[model samples]
Target: MAYLIGILITIIILLLGYIGVIEMQIRSMSEQLERRLKAHTRQNISVQLVSKNLNQLVICINKCLKAEENLRLKSMQEEKQFKEMIANISHDLRTPLTAIQGYQQLLEKGELSEEQRKRLAVARKHSEELKGLIDHFFEYAYLLNTQPEIKLKRINLTGLVTDCLIASITSFEEANKPLEFEETAPVYVEADEEMVTRIVQNLIRNSVEHSEGTIKVEVLSNKEGILRFINPVREPEKIDIQRLFERFYSGDEARSRMGGLGLSIVKLLAEQMKGNVTAEIKGDLLEIKVTLPLAQ
Candidate 1:
């Protein structure tokens, strides 16, 4: 009876020791998982214990890690390829576009009949539109490929927007659309000057192209400087407010040609300067708003 009792005691001690080992192994695995997640490392989980269940768990975890790494690498490769493709296409189109513009300028300088002159003017207009489209494409591709170096400074938002609107007066006249801008007090913001100018220009151009009636501009201030553009759209139902800022997104086929890249560029530039843009439809009107941080 004494020998049997001794054997039982020994067996209990061995079982306790095995359980302790397993607990330690589990703790080590947990720590390893945490470190791997924080560091984004490619290391696989490993177990020191010689238990079949623990080994199987480790195997499953390692497989999952390997799969995740593969997916990440694949996504990176695809993105690189897409950027390269855009860059190449933009570069290729630029040469021919430049040549076309040069020829158009030469034709303008030559003497011709009134009918010929009118036809040349039409051709010139179309060519200019094409050039603008190509320029937007190139700019969009460049923005995607490189991180922009933003020069942020305290700028008068009211003055800047006013200048942009004045410059766009000719465009509005050409489009046979009226523009209304109510002057407000000087609103100051901390933003990149060039980017802000681009944003305003793009917004104005979008309105000129899409607005059915008078285009309205307003500047307001709360905690941030807000620039608002309100325009009556022809078919409000066609415009998807949610996808307005998406690259190459357009509400209709006609808009698809002229509206490509403009809003997307505005969105990207605004985000780079720590600003935001939003669009909504109210009745027959489409209102777009841009908000920037106020200068201290």
Candidate 2:
């Protein structure tokens, strides 16, 4: 009976070994299949990502091409408008100038008596006025397109303003308008002196042109550490204050003949020197203010 029990135990141990071998083979095959499926999924995901990026790049390129085409069309339209303007300017000026030249020649030839020559002189004066207007147009247009090269340095505002107003005093002498200089203490600023002078000149001219009778100039400092010069306008219009900075805004049709770019040039120069110019129309006074950075 003992011999029979030993043989049965050996048979059971052999069966267990065979079962373990079959289980290990099944696990190996399952691992290999999983790895192949993972690689296939990863490759598909990479290809999809590449395709999406390609679509986005294609859209960006299309937008850039369309923008280039639109800009070209706009440039052509502006060129056409400029040519038409030049033609119109020539016609407006040539007609009056030609008439004046013909009348002057008749007077010079002694074809007209003294009294008739005096009448022709009136025509000549009107023609000269028209010619001056045309010349002003050319100058203002040139200034608009070409910039004056700036040489920057410290500019003394106290002396500059005093001198400018003194030079312009005779211009307003008839009106008995006195220039009220508020502050005379030397206020120095760091900027192009020539440009600043031009700015001040234009401001003074505008004040004398538009201001009632009295022109007051101030170089005052506020809590914000900004220095400004203020001028009053003579006649305030119903037009918006912002419109004064625009080109070709005339204060009066009879008094003003130029394209009204005096203030506009002042505005352009002020901006170039890291300054800002603005205007306000009170009930009757038009106030212009220019703010410039103070030199440390």
Candidate 3:
């Protein structure tokens, strides 16, 4: 009886030791997986112990990792190809557009009947609009392909917005949209000057082009500098607020010419400057807000 009891005790001890070894191996594998994922490495999780079950688990995990890595590489390649295609298309369109504009300028210099002059004026206007569209596409592609050099500095938000509005006054008048803005106290933010200027200009242009009624602008400062643009739209229900910043997503046929690249550019530039942009519909009004870090 004593010998039998001793053997039973030894078997229990061995069983517990086996379980402990399996637990440690699992923990090591967990750590290896974490390291591999964080470092984005091609290294596979390896096992130290000789267990069939654990080896199978490692194999499955390695297979999953390989699949994920392949998907990531494929996505990156596709995006590069898409950007290159856009750049090429924009470049190709610009050459012919430039020649057309040059010919239009020559036509403008020559004499013409009243009706011909009117038709020429209309052609010039549409050609200018087409040129603007092409330029937006080219700029969008350039922005995606290269990282812009940002020079961060303290900027007067109120003054910058005011300047942009003043510069865009003629456009607003031409669109017959009344502009409304109440001057507030000076607000300051830390951002890239050129980027912020572009953001403001793009927002203003968007409002001028799309607003059905009055266009309003406001600037406020708290923890961050807030620049807000409010405008009335004819059909708020048709606007997809969520996809407003998506590349090439236009909410309406009128906006199709630019392909929604203007707001997309604004969003990208704002994010690059450690800022953010949001849009929402308030009743009949569409409000777009841009927030940037306040100056210290």
Candidate 4:
């Protein structure tokens, strides 16, 4: 009986050692799988193990990893196809749109009766609006499908916002919207100059289009680059600030047909630069803040 007990103890010890080895292998495989996934590799994941249960667990994990890899490949293919389609459509439309605008200009230059001139001006106006919508569509498609390499440099946020506001003064006057910009100390950030310009232009344009009162842009130089745009909402209660950054999201159903890519693009660009953007509606005041890492 003593000999039988000794044999059982030995078997138990061997089993525990086997399990410990299996556990260590599993941990190492898990780490390797994570590294491969992070590097976006196509290597098959498999780990040898002694215990039956552990072998089964590795099998399940490998199946999941394979499925994930397949899905990733499929998504990448679809994205490439979609980007190509957008480029082709944009080029096809731009060629004819440019021709139409050119002819419209020539027509405006030619002699015409007062009624004829008014009709031509109306036609030109609609054409210009169509052009703007197409441009937005192109931009949205590009921003949504692909991540472009941005040239990051130390840029002055205050001066950039000021420049955008100054350039938009004429439009503000035309829209009868009072524009105010409070200049603070120069807030510099490491960001793509062109992206910063686009973000500012889009935010200001969004505010100008939606605001009921004055549009105010301010720069706050803090640990993070804080560029704020303040505007009074026409119906603060109805606006969903959370949905403002969603692609093709509009405040109202009436404006749904209007291309709503401006703020969405801003959010994407901000995130690509490792920055953040948010909107808050307090009573009637709408504040949109864009924060980026401040350059030392």
Q: RMSD, each candidate, Å?
A: 3.8, 17.2, 2.0, 3.2
Q: TM-score of every model?
A: 0.81, 0.60, 0.92, 0.82
lDDT of model 4, residue 178: 94
The global C-alpha lDDT for each of the candidates, from Candidate 1 onward, is 0.90, 0.65, 0.92, 0.84
Worst 10 residues of 2 by lDDT: 41-50
lDDT by residue for model 4 over 147-198, one digit each (tens)? 7998988999889889988999988888789988778878999999999999
Candidate 3 Cα outliers beyond 4 Å, as residue runs: 1-12
Backbone clashes, candidate 4 = 0
lDDT of 4 at 152: 87
- Worst lDDT 10-window in candidate 1: 252-261
Summarize candidate 3's per-residue lDDT along 16-44 as a digit string, tens digits: 99999999999999899888878877998
lDDT of 4 at 30: 76
Model 4 CA deviation exceeding 4 Å by range = 51-53, 106-121, 140-151, 234-243, 253-258, 271-274
Cα error, residue 28 of model 4, in Å, equals 3.2
lDDT score of residue 62 within candidate 1? 93
lDDT of 2 by residue, 93-128 (tens): 778688868868777788777888798888777777
Error (Å) of candidate 3 at residue 144 is 1.2
The predicted structure with the larger lDDT, 1 or 3, is 3
Poorest lDDT segment (10 consecutive residues) of candidate 3:
250-259
